[model samples]
Target: MNGRLLTGYVLRRLGQALVVLWGAITLSFLIVQLTPGDPARLMVMGGEGGDAGAANEEQLAQVRADMGLDQPVILQYLGYLGRVVTFDWGTAYSQQRQSVTDVIGQGIGSTLELGAVSLLLMTALGIVFALGSVLLPTAWLRSAFQGVTVIGIAVPSFVLAIALLQIFSFQLGWFPAFGADGLRSVLLPSITIALLGAGTLSQVFARSIREVSAEGYVEVARARGLSPAQVVLRHVLRNASLPVYTIVGMLVGGIVSGAAIIETIFGRPGIGNLYVEAVSARDFPLIQALIVLTGGIYVLVTLIVDLSYPLIDPRVVSPAARRTR
Candidate 1:
């Protein structure tokens, strides 16, 4: 019965995410089109609008028409929708001459690189801290650990990025703060992003562990004269860990988005920083495209987390006929 409900939940979530994707696409189109600047104009040049050039009105109008800018908005949307369905995104507005997929392809790897590396670091750190906090002896130490985690949650990523840059790049002369070429390049930025996740996940795991420790069955372990390690590793941590596991994917979405600000601060060529540049120039298609991609990714990640819930708790997979597929 629980299996049936879990299957149903996954399908429903997929359907809902599809709806959200559609809405996001539609809203993005409307917002970009309604905005004041000409997307084509924004796309033609680069570097802070230094040159509008001396193109005549005829040339400008011709450029617009050639790019299908003169077409009716609804018709254009239909055309764009058709291409998107076929997975054939055309050229980006900013990189007007470059294919949409090409532009995304060019930048996505870097963004993904940052996000993936950061998540790995964060997961390892968060889980370790959480487990340690649970098993550690001192109440004062636990309080201190939790306080540090809260501070991590409060500070902005950009601020962290700048400080790290100053320390590592300027003062220490350790890791090169910018270009993400290799493993060494990834270290500082990954650490910065991971810090945020570490704080949030650590608190979550700590709270869950503390709660699980208080459950009636945990007392059974205590009464049985089990060693503290045996009680925690064999009982408390397992149950406590289940809920915290769901947070892993949700945080992936955040790490990906947060990487943008962090990447830009350090002048990395990751997609997030590219997006920052794209938005400032009002590169509508690029902005819209990135938004769609990011939103889709977040939706997919959340859906995975939701489906994984039953693995955490059978109660999440209620046996109600209404809940089941």
Candidate 2:
């Protein structure tokens, strides 16, 4: 791609990312605001054994004022946007007035670690399955690989987590059943999340490989006296793998979302568990911040994937840029 086109492509992708982030932030704010039950009242009464009379008017009003709930919706939204931009996510009333950043910080590391491990496993599994489906010697073997991918896609994360826990933890005592203590603690959850993504990616990759294998260039390569493995490794693999990049980027969001359920089931500490706590306690700031964080991650990953196209294949160009030209 020309320098001018590349610059325009980057700028266009960035603009789209900003718009998506803004929409996500705005939607999260609106949903939290519209949800039944007052956060301030919830905060005041959460510790009072569910008694409505536990929190008086002054207490509720004070809590509301402290939480900026007394301000107009527009003002609150503007204030929220400012906070998000500044990375000042405010305090968590549900956590004894702890700073939101500190609260999230305590768990973000574990979540990122889980996500990173899961991503690696997912990518490796996808490539293996794709290659097996296409390169295996027998039809039944290829069919078996395809069947496994279908099962992986069909199983929900929680159900998979439970089954794995039963077999690996309870039955064999192979790994810890719960908690984020060490590497062993991460294995089951990561595997559970990886299987889901690997299933979709392998299917897409297998199709791409089949299409690429039919191209005339592939035929010429085979006729050039190169071995089957050499032609596949040198030519088919690179081209067939291009589409897999986009699938990997999209899978990140699923990994994070799945983390919530997997973490809860496995008793792991992460943003997913924090999210559940924030919602249960009506901690608006924490809830909104987590939503924005998840959305930002999705936007960033997809943006990176889009920008990488030209690097992966020079012939790749933005369709939007092409139209403009």
Candidate 3:
């Protein structure tokens, strides 16, 4: 694509991302509000109706009024939207008085670290396994790789995490069972995330490779005396990468959102854990921030991937270029 067209495409994707983010924000707000009972009351009572919650209706009314919970839902939503647009995420309701940004920041950094490790591992392992599955001469080896891929897809991440924990942490004592202490602490959890992503991608990559292999260019490359490895790497994989990239792009969200479950299973401190705590405590500001943040990340990753198609295959660029013209 020409520079002008590429720029327009990127701008269009960014605009769409903004729309999706707004929808996610609005949906999150509505869901949080629709829940039974007053959020302010729940925040104060810690989601419990016990002796400690002896405050009468009058006192609860006063609490709600103080928090602007007395405002109409639409007005509250509009006001909340304004604050969000202005980057004022408000303060945490359940924890020590801290800005919601600061609260999320703490966990976000750790989550990013974990995500970075997992993504790298997933991409590398996915490409390697996919290549091996198609390129290996032995049928049994191909079958074994396929079997592994099936297992990866069939086993839920949480279940895989627990199994990993039991075998590696409990019986073998290879790594720490919990806590994001250092590189060692991240290994098993990262593997858990990688396995899930890689498994799915391997299938995509293999299918793409198989489809590309049957194309005339692959035959032409072979006819030109390109070595098997040369044809596979230079032609086959390049063409196959479009689909692989698409899957990787989509998996970015899965890795981030799935962190909640993996983090919980591994007892790692991250946004997932924070999310769990925020929901349990009815922390509206924190929950809202997380929802927006997560949605933004997913949209951004997808946008990047969509724009990247042209770079991988000239054929993809032509379609977009034609549409623009």
Query: Compared with the true structure, what per-residue lDDT tens digits does model 3 show for residues 49-159?
Result: 343356478856765664456899878788778877887877676667588888887888889989999999999989888888887889999888877888878998889
Alpha-carbon RMSD, candidate 3: 2.7
Itemize residue pairs with steric clashes in candidate 1.
Answer: 90-100
CA lDDT of every candidate: 0.76, 0.86, 0.83
For all predicted structures, in order, the TM-scores are 0.86, 0.93, 0.90
Instruction: Score candidate 1 by lDDT.
Output: 0.76
Alpha-carbon RMSD to native, per candidate: 3.2, 2.2, 2.7
What is candidate 1's lDDT per residue for 144-250, written digit by digit as tens? 66677876699988888888889998899888978878888888999999998898898898888889889999999999999877888888886787656677877
Q: List the residue pairs that clash in candidate 2.
A: none
Which 10-residue window of candidate 1 scores lowest in summed lDDT? 46-55
lDDT of 1 at 45: 52
Error of 1 at 44 (Å): 4.0
Question: Which is better, 1 or 3, measured by TM-score?
Answer: 3
Query: What lDDT score is found at residue 80 in candidate 3?
Result: 75
Scored by Cα lDDT, where does model 3 land?
A: 0.83
Compute the lDDT of residue 2 as modeled in candidate 2: 77
